[model samples]
Target: MYGIVQGVGFRPFVYNAAKKYGITGWVNNSGGAVTIDLTGDICNVKKFVIQVVKNPPFPAVVNKVRCVSLQYLHYDDFNIKRSSKESDTVKFIPPDMGTCENCLKDIMDKRGKRYRYAFANCTKCGPRYSVIKELPYDRRRTTMNSFEMCSSCKDEYTTPRDRRFHAETNCCQKCGPSLVIINNKGEIQKCEDVIDETIELIKNGKIVAVKGIGGFHLVCSGRNKVVIGELKNRKKRPSKPLAVMMKDINTVREFCEVNEKEEEILKSSKRPIVILRKKENIDLPENIAQGQKKLGIMLPYTPIHYLLLEQLDVLIMTSGNISGCPIEYKNSSALKNLKNVADYFLMHDREIYVPIDDSVVKVFNGEECIIRRGRGYAPSAEHMEVQDNIVALGAQEKSSISISKNSYVYTSQYLGNLQDFNCYRNYQYVIKHLTGILDVNPKIWVYDMHPLYVSSAYKKEGIKIRVQHHHAHMVSCMAEHNISEKVIGVIYDGTGFGLDGNIWGGEFFIGTRADFNRVGHFEYVDIQGGDAAIREPWRCAVSYLYFCGYDGKFIKNIDKNILDAAIQALNSSLNCYKSSSLGRFFDCIAVLIGLKNFITYDAEAAIALENIIDENVKETYKYKIRNENNVFLIEIKDILQGVLNDINCKLNEGTISAKFHNTISKLTCDLVLKLSKIYSISKVVLSGGVFENEHLLKAVYYELKNNGLEVFFNSKTPINDGGISFGQIAVAEAVTKKQSRE
Candidate 1:
């Protein structure tokens, strides 16, 4: 059955297959599913099932299909049946697909009718989610209804022998969207051609807002500093790095290092904007990525992008939407909201099926790193070992979901931060869409332990399970690698739900997918005003330094009295929340060393610390260890206290940051090494958001390997909370399966 199967040209596929097998049938979409009834000889019916099972179609991930045979019902030749209003609810939908090879080859074919067509597509490709407005996907329900089909195109669409027959998305220059060129006064301007006019305007330094896959893109020539600066000025995006589009991988290599992972990400079907380290010698302007070390780059995910840059140089293709909102895709809205921001609008009449924002990616340890999951990367299922079909609703902040059915776990694309109401509505929208696309009717559910998490409120039906925060993080890494074997999981992040009813961030749990023990851990320090310390690092420093030799009453003599007061208030608390969080430790140390007193972004202090460290300096830290209460402990406080004495030194910040990084690595290595002889855990997984720091990840990975241990790293998804939903789903599945087995 086809729910989202309507707009994606499902009828054409059924018709062609029937014709090839010499069978007669009528296929149509009803309610949310596409149904087909066949009346033919026994051989044809059997061939239908055989072929459908073997090879269905490109990009059509057939979740399942049921076949039934009966006595022949009298029927004539095969025909496309009109859609009905009712059907079973087992049908699945499909996400918006990129351009197909057939259309791509046709567009590139110089002699073909639709040569170099920017809006060219067939039944196999083009918009599905953005343009769709109702069930039983039809021309009337889509934006395509506005365009009357041209005579030539209509003939091919109706002809039974043609590949374009019944292809609803079938279009050409005669009946497709166009680029209208005009000057500042709205005067119609004349030019040689679309490419030439756009190129000339780009060379002359005009900001062109081009419509693409799920939304509009604000384009400007990267070479012109004035134009780029104007784009930033008008877009209200001065500090945020703008994603740049190059012609191909060759040009991309000139600006950034393209290893196998980076190259794979650049060429991936999703075509996400990949964050890469900028080459030191690149002559690009500084306005590209303000206050950031990496530049966001992407290859063309759409045909229009390739044609637009065919003549023009590198183009700054930022999302064509306003800040603090979803990307703009509707024609009327774009005209109203973006009219002031863009000088000229390169528009089209074809409708965008969805407002899917650009997918963002990065490379880590030679694998594709999905940061913002969208477009080509989403709605695809990941088949993993699980107990039951469980939907793990993710946390409130940086939300996404992991739904498991049968043996597969499908993680939804990046849903925006869930703090805003619009983002919340959008999260629900994505949930409905993903459920429709993958056909996941969860039999059970899982949620974050945090009661206030946005996704924790679902209680409509089924068995609900609340999973701890750090446990979910650990299991996510386990499920991604399908690790049934036992290992020591080091989950070090800012905050997580502790088993002992405390906030745990930095933890070492020794176990497999289902079993675990908090074998060894660091001393818990006060959080000092809860989340306030996360924003103001000085509060954390004040709390940490006060306990370790720095005067707790120094606030009377200090200029920043608020930091001292926070420490004072928290010092005498009856219930001081303590954590062994490695992430919190990093923040506290950053404040201690004068790198930062407050943070504007998450991980900014740690990222900047890694950015300045000189990798060539081969330095080792003295790690202190103790076996207390039959548990091994690495004394990180010793190094923290020692650093306070040398704060007056004139050495570079690189040396200081490197020393801390090395110290942390050494302590982790020492603890693991001591545990190896005592315990049989030879496998270790280095996970959490902190793994996003490549510098820190490198040191930990090498140190663990030197201890003769196998490590599982976050190469696919972010080790952060972004990937926690997957872990939650895995834990739920494992628990359910265990119960059934027991």
Candidate 2:
């Protein structure tokens, strides 16, 4: 059996099953798979195999199981054997799981050995990918190897019937890792109880860096605006929303609305931060989300988190890092990097071999969409039909790496953008670690087509293939849906290098996994000052107005000198690049409606626009679709004029935003219907960061489906750049196969 069989109590479950079925067999971990040898009656063996395959232990994902008839040596009884050092085949290393109910009960039991233990874990729940250093996932190959189990723990580990049997991370307070509270000056603070002291510090409005299963979290009281502002100033994070760790589901329900699907994702074993809509007139500070309408909320997923949150209702739990840096995982690094940002440190002795961020998710149209794939939902592997060993270095932003081995593509967790030096180094480290753990030697290297991307420029000794960015976006959704035939693809985002050497974001294509033809796209507009147009929305606004035969005199709250410089750049074509990005289009509208002048984060303007939309508005702005040389161009000149007219009439921002969104949705449906009619295709795939907006996604999804066509979006992988690496792998395989066929 392969796929997530290691370190998940699969062997113990198998051993127990064999004894129950009156069979003699041995089970052991080999590489990443569980191997079993059985000698018994044919019917009994078949029944045992069926039971094991059908009913795996909690959190165990059995992807494939194979059985072969062989001459079995006579064994007296079933037993668990030692692991083998076979490294030929590939198997999955499970992602780190949230604390299970059984383990939580053990921690709460006063008479138990692990009562009130901060590091309490069982086979069903604990760190897996974070602490693992090698294959065959044994204690000796993990960070837990340093701790020596006490006699009590050793007895439980040796007992076959015990839940902790062969649990590699099993230990008590006496033998496992312990926590300590320290001042920012690196001196250990003498305290009676560390958990109590940490709780007291947080309640007293002190910022504490709490080490977690994957990395460190900078935690504070979320309800206190003054403390949150102080944290923002200290961490140099100005406007980005900070995630809150609520005590329980009831606390989450107190502040935000939760539906059935959202609640299921929140209380799941893989606890991720769910973006929820805040209730009207809630007591949360405006600075928490900084003008956004949603809040990122999560429940305590670890024993230490449960202990710390026991005395507090809510705490601001953000990544322990400065702005534009990867999360700090090592104790010494945390001390050195975060000493100035944190007031106190909740230190632990357990090592984190890999640092993973918290996963972010949201529910749209009753489906859970992953925004960021990390701690509880990362190191995700999927089976694919491919011939060669492949490694796909993903795009620059939302960086991740993927490796293919044994016909399975394993994608790494979300690594931050590679623009920062520290993030770049961490990206390299993750690549080496993932490839080493899976033992994959890359015969093919795949990357994006953008020459300026750090991932595209990476040096490796293999056959290199550069894939178009938006095509990868389209195929990513297609591959997730197992679609191999041709379909209409709607790909939109902030930036992608076009085949004509321009930036492409708003795009439509008719394509298969191997190839695609550009069918329609938004018309190109000049991005003044190059990359600065992305940061300053007013610049994009001026560019759009200039192209629409309007002057910048009507715009307000922008520096006159900078505005003139932007116009000059546009006029002379200096540092101006033509972009067809719908994201920039949203930014332009955001500035025109006086939503924001500048942005501090990615998609800030677009998010603000989405937040103010009135779902009841049925009106849409005028748009023109022109067929220019067999390719449809979605012209926004009329739409720009409509937005200007609304601004002149002093219309409400909500109405304007809603009208613009509706126009896009209607135009999308119209364009897809036209293409479907022309090409005789019935399936439409939508993929990109723009689809992260729930309103647009729902509108486009249902509109296409209502028109007698099949609609698909990414569910298994991210719809953003985070899923680009997996898509690159898909494209590489298809291209290679096509080449061989030719």
Candidate 3:
């Protein structure tokens, strides 16, 4: 069968297969196939065909390979022929794959020709999509075009028996990408010798920004607290943990424990930074994780990283970009943009055409933790039974695009919340590339119910479907579980634009994974401008305390300056927004206990509270609930009042946090029990971003099961807003399918 597959070394692989089996043919890449003119025995030809089809080459995806009718060659041998450009319209482009074990050994092996070469890679390893500027995945079509193979390397490439033969990324120090180093002053420290100098600088406690596969990473000596601190100061990334990269699985175990599942994810082609818990007594910089208990650690995924870290032993390789900005890919861009952040710039010549940020994850319950899906995890098409192609632009925050083409869902790499032009621009770039890769012509567009979301605008060209925020939250868990049956969805999050023009967070639903009907939600309060209370937690604190009959005494009991600020904050109607938000309620609880009236980041107060609580501890008091209109409502006002009286007491923060966590758990269980008895249903699915708190997750899980109810959560993707888009798409698909049926 003639097709578009020539010039990709398909012929050489066929020739090699012919040698493996006793066959005679003249194979060539004429029209994208092993065009064979053979006069061979049927059985040998059959074996040749099978081998050719099964193992064409390292770089081949082989979308369609079919044998043709009888064509006889009066030749005694199988030979390779030059390629022609006449192929079909459809071209199967392969995404980037990681280094193969053979290539890794060859790089590290002393006897190998490509010894200790940072750029040593082949078709099975190294950059693919990121380095490719055009299709047909050749040296000319890639960043490697600048680096012509030498005579020795060329022989290996042309040898049919050699694995490196025709490998696209084959390179060595003499003819491949070069490295250079510059100090903070923009002066080249070592123009000709970078790898060794960069390693020495890192070992000397200097932070160097190095260009990587998808972007730049600010590298520093992880073992040096002072250097890490300096890197943190320059990066301006406070509190958030800096990711630490180790050598290998063994090194990872030396720093942290890795279970079978954790090891599996670590070794996967998409080598994401898996946030593993620190093994006891493993000393690391305090700033690495800040106040958190677990350290975000990742193993080396690339040969360059392997070589660099192998020399330095341990280095703190944080993302090579400004905080909240896209990762830097180009050396010039990193040099220019990272001038203010990095102490040194480690430059490289290979071009980065596609930006892929490091994937981040955690492991629990013996399964993979997908905190941020990118690199190896991305473009991993989630096969669902969808009817048509649709584009679902996730929310502006923690952005991801879900593309559905006849049941396969392909989500783009993690695009951060569209707060800046950089984020928005990257969002556009990722979307364009993603649409190109999937070859999807979407007719229907999906978005979060919020009309003003950037993602909503992206899909303006299609039949737009607005998905409810909490409903989508539930649907995410449903999607993760691949649940086709109906179940109760216990959904709670920070905030979502409610159907009634109010802000919603805490919600409960009874529906299938596809569709959910809002059964009960937290009591609607006037969220004045939606964002007013989020920035100022004191407003939420004051509102909750005031509703519970406190004349803001908790503030007065504190410093006069604090009390005055609280008074002014309460008086300013412009700053106040009434809400029954569970997250804000947690913030209010933190405030009521005189813990914090202000926060520097989103979920700061809540996260701090979780940090304080002992998972082994339990809430001494139980929560009370009120049933309204066949829905159970937990009277949080009572909890607010009780903590108000104990404002000045030496209150146990753990107890308060536990009480808060347990109150929600008890309330949820009570709701499920009462609702199920009323409706004769016995299953509940717990979802939402709030469940990321391990303490609360376990509490809710056990309490619900103790009450004879089935519970499900995001064991894979986060239970946070990061998972919102998946849920939105599921809901949109259901709506679309139901509409079609109607």
Clashing pairs in 2: none
Better model by TM-score: candidate 1 vs candidate 3: 3
Q: Candidate 2, 202: how far from true, in Å? A: 0.7
For all predicted structures, in order, the TM-scores are 0.82, 0.99, 0.87
lDDT of 1 by residue, 1-742 (tens): 5323555566778788888887886888765566788877778878886775466666554555656666767777788987775533443334566676678788789998888788777766776656665556666766788887899999988877676776666778898777666543455567767666777788889987778878888888988888898888777765557889998888899888778878876775557788988888687877887646788998876678777778865889998866655676766777677777777767677777556777777876666766666776655456676754578887665567887655667777666667666667777776776555445676788888876666766665889988888778888888888787777888778777677777777677787666577777766777676776776766666767665657543222335566556656776862357767777778776766667667655665666667767676656556676667876565666777656644656557677777778777767777777676678778888788777777777888888887678888765655888788888888887777777799
Candidate 2: segments with Cα more than 4 A from true spot:
none
Q: Tens digits of per-residue lDDT for model 2 on 1-742? A: 8878888889889988998898897999998999998999879988998889989897787888877878758999999998887767668887898899999998889998888899999899889899999989889999999999999999989888999899999989899999998889999999899999999988899999999989999999999999999999898777889999999999999999999999999999889999999998988888999878899999999999998877898999999998889999999999999999999999899999999999999988788888899998889888888764799999988988888988888889999989888999999999899888888878899989999998866798989999999999999898888999999999989999999999999999999999999999999999887788888888889989989988898668998998888888889988999999999999999999998789888888999999999878999999999999999999989999999999899899999999999999999999999999999999999999999988998999998898899999997789999999989999999999999999
Task: Give the alpha-carbon lDDT of every model.
Answer: 0.72, 0.91, 0.70
Quality of model 1 by C-alpha lDDT: 0.72
| TM-score computed on alpha carbons, candidate 3 | 0.87
What C-alpha lDDT, on a 0 to 100 scale, does residue 179 get in candidate 1?
Answer: 64
For model 3, the stretches where C-alpha displacement exceeds 4 angstroms are 1-98, 133-141, 524-532, 551-575, 591-601, 642-648, 680-683, 702-710
RMSD of each predicted structure: 4.9, 1.1, 4.4
Question: CA lDDT of 404 in candidate 1?
Answer: 66
